[model samples]
Target chain A: MAGQPPKVDVPILKDLTIDNITENVHRINSQGSDPRLKYILERLVTHLHDFARETRLSTDEWMAGIEFLTAVGKKCTDVRQEFILLSDTLGLSLLVDSIDHPKPPSSTEGTVLGPYHTHDAHDLDLGSAISGDPSGTPLLCLCTVKATSGAPIADAKVDIWETDSKGSYDVQYSDYSGEPDGRAVIKSDKEGVFWFKAIVPVPYSIPFDGPVGKMLKVLGRHSWRPSHMHFMFEKGGFDRLITTLFLRGDPYETSDAVFGVKDSLVIELGTVSAEQAKKYGVEEGTKLLTHDFVLVTDEETRKLRDEEALKAMRKLGREGMTIINGQLVPDVD
Target chain B: MAGQPPKVDVPILKDLTIDNITENVHRINSQGSDPRLKYILERLVTHLHDFARETRLSTDEWMAGIEFLTAVGKKCTDVRQEFILLSDTLGLSLLVDSIDHPKPPSSTEGTVLGPYHTHDAHDLDLGSAISGDPSGTPLLCLCTVKATSGAPIADAKVDIWETDSKGSYDVQYSDYSGEPDGRAVIKSDKEGVFWFKAIVPVPYSIPFDGPVGKMLKVLGRHSWRPSHMHFMFEKGGFDRLITTLFLRGDPYETSDAVFGVKDSLVIELGTVSAEQAKKYGVEEGTKLLTHDFVLVTDEETRKLRDEEALKAMRKLGREGMTIINGQLVPDVD
Candidate 1:
């Protein structure tokens, strides 16, 4: 089309106001084979244009933003996803997660995936100590996994990770190099029960060495996340439930920086006397906590998750070729 | 703050909804060290959050966007500014330019300062053909510069650039090494007149070897810009005028891909007979055209332009540092 005669749009330079930018995006036949991408990109363009006009963003401001994003990309490595932290602090990640994973009243609620979970969570037997470091006050924890209908979800896989008493996950410490710590994978026994003795969770700040930290400083916001334990549950024929558990009454719970904590995800931390701790074969005056998880992964859940996956595919341009003027076409330079 | 006890936010996870994100951005002590920057960032965060919610943007979709931006950054260099191209194609650069350079009724209009514009536009004298390479149809051109109030703008600096007959800028051709071809800078005579013999511009495509090209393909939009000549005029103590002039009646005059053609910037190209061409000391049956530019830089125009610049500064966080809970504070990690 470079050398072809161009379709002239007669100049009418009168009164082309800023609002036209928002409208022009929709008029460009940007819609492609996937109606969903059309919807998403259209929304994005509208929002972005509105943002520019409302603030009257200048060229310098825009260039500064571009530079900030470039730095964020450069900071990303195998162990760090600064973009995810960016989305988390902005509350976008949790918002999308919530939209994609709504559950029945009894099911465990999902929350923010606060940048610490890894793929290597390995299984251990029930009643085992999740952390062998023995560096903090112990917690005897027990949990159950069940289906929405109250049936025991046998062999459901659960991954758990939490901060140490010092409020730092092992990976966040100097020696770990982002290695998994205070984390373990365990399967529910025949009775659908999982138990472990580990340290009590504490509030912690997110990584502050990158662009997200700079943004937070500019916004006058803190980077603290409320004390909580991460949990992910999955079993065949059931929708995977990724969530976190917070100790009720934790002070920072209201402002979990990334806003990951939910009321339904809260459970009590019970204190046990030295004698009772001895009976459980644990440290004296230990804390005891127990909770059950309910999952929903039947037909309706499957369809919903499938829709989320499809939206992702459309975004990646994996689902269809870009259509031009309602006609199938390959990319033309 | 990593090991310090977090500021207690008294736990109450209820009322944290998608709508809260929009409201929360505004609630920030958006008053920064630069009040304007605070306002713009607040608006940006609000619009962006709302867009995410409206789209229910999934993690994969967000990541795909990040990857797209990263590629755009990596594609940019000293020779290539994909970011500017992004702004131009999206119609933003023109929109902002229009707002900042609005003129009175008699003043020449301004348009996009396309990515091809370089700092290297050098000086040439009147009657000199811009392209000594002698590859295009000759054009004997004449132009004048004036003040909005009818006074001649003596000694005004005029910089002009255009595509050759084949509709390609020198920079787009590898052999040129971005040297000037159909482009020149010249000083207006005492009568505010400028003259030259050069090739007539034809419609052209922007560089298509980058991510922007891929975006154009996916959006089903052409990459062509209408045939035009770029003009930048500046005189001592007057506002600079940066714009493009498109030939009237050209086919792409109406459907300019970049939406740069303005009726006020459009003029005629007249044909000259072989004898007349000979009399003008040029090739037989050549073409002739003339245009006059009027600049606006009086008190009224200065005030308006100043206001526009201020608005942009405000958008760049010009008013204050970010205030937190109504108090000025440094960034906290």
Candidate 2:
């Protein structure tokens, strides 16, 4: 560690003011070893430095900045994260999701990973709908899986959930559930089609209990996120897409708090005859949203399938565990 | 806005298992409009992705990650930022500081900005230290501000502060006078010689009331930052440097939770006699550390002489403001 300091090392003490933040970032970019890392940090530094300069940030202001971030962390619990909400509201999550989940033409578009995607969704029969309430306008949720072309691909796992007519998802209305509301895992039938019955999703607001809410108040922005239904479409040889379907013409659709809308993901809820609703076990006159998903498969998707298999094997204990005094140990012969 | 998606844009439901985070980063590097921004964000995205993969992260874990960041934001009030601490502990602050304040062959090296540097410290006469604690060993803090080749830098601003012997900083202890604590703002004498009396700083821990502490707990790491004195040196026209004089041999130096240390920045805190201390108007029989700082000057520093001018500009129209007509309006002549 005591080698001669490089000759290029020069003292820069007298000119390292806030204004030099940009130049300093540039110098680091040119001098640092990891180009990619340097790039990202450089941009971040510029933005941060610019923010400081713009605010003419006081030491107290800076300290408060730190304190604000600290609160974001403390507010997290087993079910929610305000920081993610921060990122989500900042549009980073949607931008990232868009960048990460590029789809084939005509395929269902992806959206935000809403806060209520719990691990314990109950699996239900193909025709079973989640809404038990006899009130509210009934709607048919129908979707078909297809390849990039028009060919149907059957037996895709389609997990679906949405807010009740009251605009409350099960996770949000934890008190109102005998069985959890708005959560159901189903598989497409042999004809590559899946249908369920549920009430139309109504627009809902983002959580207002945390820092995100505080930020919204500070920024004079509303706390509402657009109405949408969460979906997870998976097949053995296709990449899993965790997405959402937005109700077309919903006022919030165009200005989703998280910026999660795409034209491809918006679908219309069409009015159906009462006779048709009765045939589908719905009360005659009702509305239905007909939607279909087309998924493209590739080598990377095959790899994901393999990984999923490995995960299943691990979960099922196909790899035998050791028994010691009636206790199961993970690493015994 | 939807005049046909860009040719490169893939559908949202296409195969999204692409393993090209790196390649995409490189592509963005050369092809992006704002090369600097592209470089920065691309690298950040890569590192973030890598961090996620390295952790074998899960949805809940990712949720936790999001929550951690959110809590960081929430913890940010007027005086704290847990995320900065997170960055500090992860070596990002030092990395940024070093990148911004590269050391020259002869000038003193710069370091990270510590947590307690918010207020615009009050200026003091030569030899008058801010804090008056008697718990730690007393020291004669002295420095000669010279150029890279040893030319004197007279009338330079030499702001300084360090913890008392009992390891408490003025800001951290109770019953503080409204004045700043453990801090002194002084100008170098005509000979570029600056000297004062103060106790050696003791190693201390970061404020432990936030998410940073929780993160440390999860990582099984200690939260102690090393013993060091804060310094901000400026001259007319020169870039201001925020740095620290670290105590060598400090147990926490190598593992300073914030990692704000450097070899050139370490100064010897030696022993001196009571008579010598008295000669310096310091109490007799107190120990002392003698050190000299070498500063470099250029057009950038010569401008720092206008610190007063800078201060004046910040105190705009406030001088004329009054509660006129029962409302807080400016007083008119």
Candidate 3:
């Protein structure tokens, strides 16, 4: 090579086209910031720009998206999280959740972190009831938390929340009714057991009075989330598990709108006699569900799980036959 | 067929994956909303979902986008339009402008309708000055509006706004200093001729104090807009033309941050003698520009131009080689 081609500073060109946008995103040499944040944001910009290109999005369409986002933001309050609901309905939440807390075999799988989980889950004693109200079907939950190595994970915090039998979260009910009623937290005893009596979970549609609801209706899809109880088990030195347990035979179980249902998380409820219910100081003819959760023992396992899930999820997205403008086209990864 | 397969409602299957998101997008139907808006929104959803899949965006990444958008919305007020600025920097404003008002070959091609156009231009006589401030370089404008057939278009409203030589628009300065001072509306006389004395256009960066600014900095791109005067010519029958004429040889002319510069919109400025400036009631040594705009007389031409430009612009986006994770990938369109 007698003559070397001059080095053209390509990334700093600032062309402002979709092409330049692609270059600029990668060229972001952040001097100081969380490297993790930078990595996430850079990838996000690449995908967003690529999306704009693939659709050949017009300005009106872009503006419309902005307006919809603004409306969603405005709709958010202390009780309502339109963003999470948006992510849930779009299925991005599932993609993220699946990657975030990947479950090893025999481990409890996670679901959509629905907008109803409050950190202040009231501490309940073992075998105590979660709800005070005697509404809907009576139910009892008995949970055991343990390490994948089959050892008890004593003193772990088991956070539990679920909709009432009618399928409404406490926050939503508390807006007009009093404080939300059917949620609580209990610590696992030395035997890694925690139990609570509460109403059974039933299928419920997501709140559809806002933009997300409008999107669901327009897309000709149901806003129903399969009936399930939310759960999170946390202990120092062990990977945290964010999950949901679905009733085995709920009608919407297989067709959950947010794709939160998983096989391992489902449990069958058996009828408990009035005498058994009275022993727990609850209503007669209660239903009881027993569940055991296995957590990954090491942090490396959890990280590896997340990495593997991301790869698998990416492959799933890449394999789907994509449709655009009413035409079926193979997705290009 | 001996056996008919069970009819499955295809679109309602809410499998929260990229493929399902793609399917759901094409399934949208409008029983009653504006059909055009419905179509646009459906395409938007498809492209957006594909983008997420292509990137395999994590939850933290998605939430970061939400937070950025929420902050952008919160930063917006009556005096500041952060959304418009965001659109401008992303080159979306120009794409929209080109489609909304297509320029016939002889007609003036429009540029980004920068956020400063206040339609309330004071109807000044032919030779009034837009800025009374004596701080910057002086300039006089002479404009002639004509139809594509070379016919003078009388009674056309010529609304104009520009930043001073100091590169600050009146709206931005108004808050700290006082009333916005550098914008005015002057009607063309019967001969389709109008002139106004004001400061020559100077390159200016967009107001970079909000989330958009933070975004620009992080993206490693300048927020500077090329110097140009915003113009709008409207009549009863002609397509309204929104344009900006950059000072011919400005260094940033080719690299406009908003992609607002057009070959036809750049015009060179000639210096006028002190006596000539006095005739126009301005300072002694004033800059002068004589530019004529040709307008498309019919609606059909405008629509056709927009349709054609959209095709070309979209093709430009689709042509770029997309690289993700160091892999040169072909965009799934």
Candidate 4:
């Protein structure tokens, strides 16, 4: 009742078969003005139909999938992204990150930006404490920002956030007041040094009260991610880095439920002596985490990304695919 | 925080690459107690990862897909199922129906069960009128239920429903009254005959106020379905039949938006005489539609379904797959 028949010429689709349905769908969707959308949808439909056919998927199984996806969508809210969780758990997030954000060997590797990041983190001076709660072992984080050429990146903005000893972000609380905790924004000094004091993060489960949690149970997989601190760096003329540092000894480090851990991103924490802690205005026996983050310049990043795309296009060309007006299309010669 | 690490021996998932990620996922999920679930997930993950790699899917495109699925999920409600509509438009519903309900050559072919059926309907005597509205031209439908052997099946429960003159189902109205209109359930007599009077259904658009509607627009496809009447039949020893009869001359008969039109289901209506109309207690100038619905006995249907499953398993076996304890698994040497 809300739409009229097509005013343009459209094909009459009848008696669709599994073997011919994919082609018909592609034909119908070819009418879209956006060539990129048409390309993506064509590939999606092809893969979906192929999957169903190869598996000989039953109606009950299809219904189960539909219900599962519906529950996942219904579980999403302002602070929670269940779909992203699903992608992460399925290893898709890492695949996309690897393809889109390929970096030079000297540059730091990036990982999934979990759903807990917020824009309201408090901006504090270097070496200031970020935690409001007076629990957990105090940690002194000493970090340096540098270019791939080993030059100091002065005045770089570093955003950091992590869970408390109880393994929960501040926003996860039911009675969360509109205040930031265990998170902050700090700037690197002229020497490219930036330090902060906060509680050491604890191994935590990705929110397990939703549909994703139920899926993990069905997969016989755990939901625990290694205890890790998140860092996002932004600077002029450089690529923004979104990454995490996993504590080397965390039980879940190697088998992170979200599949976010990389060997280079894992680090061992050292002990901060009383004398060294005095310089950081912290108590004795505090945990120490020291690391240097290497960043690629924006120009270099763009070049690398373009090269990767060209490489992919070449690979696809070998398989009889070609790019037409910025859209990947079959080479139908 | 709510879940501990897996108590069982779980594989350490680390450094996942696009090529290796699918196998790792399958390995992790292989610990599930249900072999069928594991088999389905393995195939799903394989197809999903293959799609990404073949297309070189970018981060932006992946995020767009996630957002689209979330929107589709959010649009579902108690009375509306947007996911089903999405499945219908993508031809998955039809594909599943075609595979699951393969009929003998003598039996009527079945089509998609559009997401508009309801369990609640008024049961009436033979030749009773179904429409509460008095506006549209009256139609008299004559139907018979017969077995594949041409034996009349007595007392078959025939359920019928359709749209009114305005091309809208009663439930589609915001202020829908509780009364039923243009829909009813009638039973066949000893001769397997049932007749009912109702308004002639008109071509109508699927609900286009939701995410699926937007998707159709993006694909440059119209949402109009041909004018059709739904019929479902049930008997003690026969398989339930869910199907529709499309008006042969309707503009969308060849290209139903939902890909639901089957060649065998297209039908033509005849003109009823004044005297013929009086037999049904309707005014003169009534339209007439007569058809016989052939049903396969439950035992015969079971045999056909088993044969289909065996054929699929054999096909997969030729592709290095096997059914193990009712679960499809890779036949590794």
Name the top DockQ candidate: 4
- How many pairs collide in each candidate, listed in order? 22, 64, 1, 1
Residue B5 error for model 2, in Å?
15
What DockQ number belongs to candidate 4? 0.63
- Indicate the DockQ of the complex predicted as candidate 2: 0.13
Q: Rate the local accuracy (lDDT) of all candidates.
A: 0.70, 0.60, 0.67, 0.82
Q: For every model shown, what is its TM-score relative to the native structure?
A: 0.75, 0.60, 0.78, 0.93
Candidate 1, lDDT over the whole model? 0.70
- The TM-score of the first chain in every model comes to 0.81, 0.74, 0.83, 0.92
Error of 2 at A306 (Å): 6.7
Q: Each model's fnat?
A: 0.28, 0.12, 0.12, 0.64
Ten consecutive residues with minimal summed lDDT in candidate 1 chain A?
A321-330
lDDT of candidate 1 over B1-333, digit per residue (tens): 522333543233453555565455445324246556566666667767767655556556776876676666667665567777777777667676666566777788888788777668779887778865566777788788988788888888888888778877777676666566778888999988888888777777776667777777666566777667898887877778888888887666655656676778888888766876765677666777788889887466657655654554456565633334322222444
Of candidates 3 and 1, the better by lDDT: 1
CAPRI quality of model 2: incorrect
> What interface Cα RMSD is found for model 2?
13.6
Residue B39 accuracy (lDDT) in model 4:
67
- For candidate 4, the TM-score of chain A alone relative to the native chain A: 0.92
Which TM-score value belongs to model 4?
A: 0.93
Q: After superposition, how far is residue A167 of candidate 4 from its true place, in Å?
A: 1.1
